[model samples]
Target chain A: MKAVLPDDLCKIFSKAGSSGSWHKYLKVGDWLVLLLSCALVVSSYTLLWRGGVADRAIVKRDGQTIIEISLNSARKTRVEGPLGTTVIEVQPGRARVFSDPGPRQYCVQQGWLTRAGAVAICAPNHITLELNGRGEASYDSLGY
Target chain B: MTPSGIELPITEDDRRIARYTAAAIALTVAEAALPSPLPGIKPGLANIIVLVVLLRYGWRDAAWVSLLRVVAGSLVIGQLFAPGFFLALAGAVSSLAALFLAVQLPRRWFGAVTISLLAAFAHIGGQLLLARLWLVPHDGVFYLAPLFATAALIFGTINGLIAARLIRQVETI
Candidate 1:
């Protein structure tokens, strides 16, 4: 007589074999992990690529960061530069050089910087203003 | 003591580790040849071998195979002791740590696929963290998180499926 497992017992063993393998290998926990991983990957987009709204704006006078303003509450800050006092306006989601005593009002005319990596330079006043955020930058490189 | 060669005692476990390590290293070198559109993204095919060793042998032996693969593969690619080596080392160590936690789950439910997916995420997470801390030192490094995480998901699922198949073959044999 040939030695072999009983038919019923062998059925249970053969059921878990590699052929038609996905159902066999993906168990309860594995399925749960797959679901969670998919969800995580989906959520990463909203969390990481929230790049439009910059969180902070930095005011630099002659290459020195003088004020780091949070772009949450609306406010106005004036910084004295080589030309004169340069006014920067901050809104809930953006910042701009409101006014500058520079010969050319380039920074003021640049309008609102609503995206991370956005920048405006009041070159005549030697004051530079830029936005930074925790999220991804919109442009590969920003500023004129 | 003369010119006679001295033989160091090698256990069965040592031999098994050596063999698995060699396999993993070969996969790593082969995978390196594939061009990545992004700087740090790869399918991480060698992870299938690492997961197999972890399941067949144990965590410690699997760890040995994984780490040796990083060092040996780096050497083969002429990246030994370079920044790339450190990145690879971080990925290996973190994925092993994740695997160490994975085996704690019930084997009946958590098999090679689940184990491989967890390790894949851990590997990319570790590399990104290292790059943020030491390499770029900026939040911009994390700008690539979604990309890497997506890579981890797609490649992780594929690698896990292949690993699950291999583990089944190993079991039946």
Candidate 2:
């Protein structure tokens, strides 16, 4: 006795059998897009690396620039935002969100920021800190 | 298998949608359960169902399956109405749009792999845009774009090959 194939499986098999040639599916246009995407990724990273080191850290709260601190100086400041307060610390060419009034404390968990365009954001408190260096800022900021 | 051997009222399209959605949702949940080494990098195995649907059916069916997967997957992962949900929704919308446009290109010129790549890029791009506008609100967010793009390239190709192989297996059956 022949075993009966499931309907869904049968559908896939029959459909695939009747479909057009699979060998010719990829063409020059597809290759072009793939190559361009790869190039874009590579060039963007190269540009990021070339952005050099940052010397300043800018603090912002609720879309407003709060203060700019030189990374050369080690200091700490508190910024108030909608959610609450965030303590920002800058030390020897690097900065970080020392503490924030949030449950997760994500900004604090981001550790340190030393890159030219690295950022630490406390979304709940609407606070953002960005690093700036001697060289030009690379493609905006890294989005997660 | 019904009591009276009677056919179900569901149409073929409906059945296909249900089957593909189930597959995508399973993949999504499994992916979520796994620990990702990086923040935005995942294998995106769910995309295989979308690619297969697009190839066997059409964009309309594929869109339904993809969007349903995002919504249901988010719900399953308990992320509904959260920032993550919104980001996932945005990614789904953009990827579907990308797939729609990619489908317009001649099939011979672009296969599952190319379409997957475009969709993956669009997905990451959408998430980044949403993150900048709402979540982080910093230009620094774009710094992660290259990393996300690299992940997309790798996952997209792998998923595309899996879909292609499945399609070939189905044909052989």
Error of 2 at A116 (Å): 4.2
lDDT of 2 by residue, A1-144 (tens): 012433545566556545455444445776777788789789978875555588899998877889999989899999998777899999997999999998899889999998777888898899999988774545553333
- Over B1-173, each residue of candidate 2 has an lDDT whose tens digit, in order, gives 44786667988688778778888898899999889887667888989989888888999999999989999998999988899889888888999999999888887667778888989999999999998999988666776777888899888777776677676666666
Q: What is the Å distance of residue A49 in model 1 from its true position? A: 2.1
Best by DockQ: 1
lDDT of 1 at B8: 83
Deviation in angstroms for A25 in model 1? 2.6
Model 2 chain B: weakest 10-residue lDDT segment is: B164-173
Q: DockQ for each of the predicted structures, in order? A: 0.28, 0.24
* lDDT on C-alpha atoms for all candidate structures: 0.83, 0.82
The segments of candidate 2 whose C-alpha lies over 4 angstroms from its true place after superposition are A1-29, A52-144, B1-9
TM-score top scorer: 1
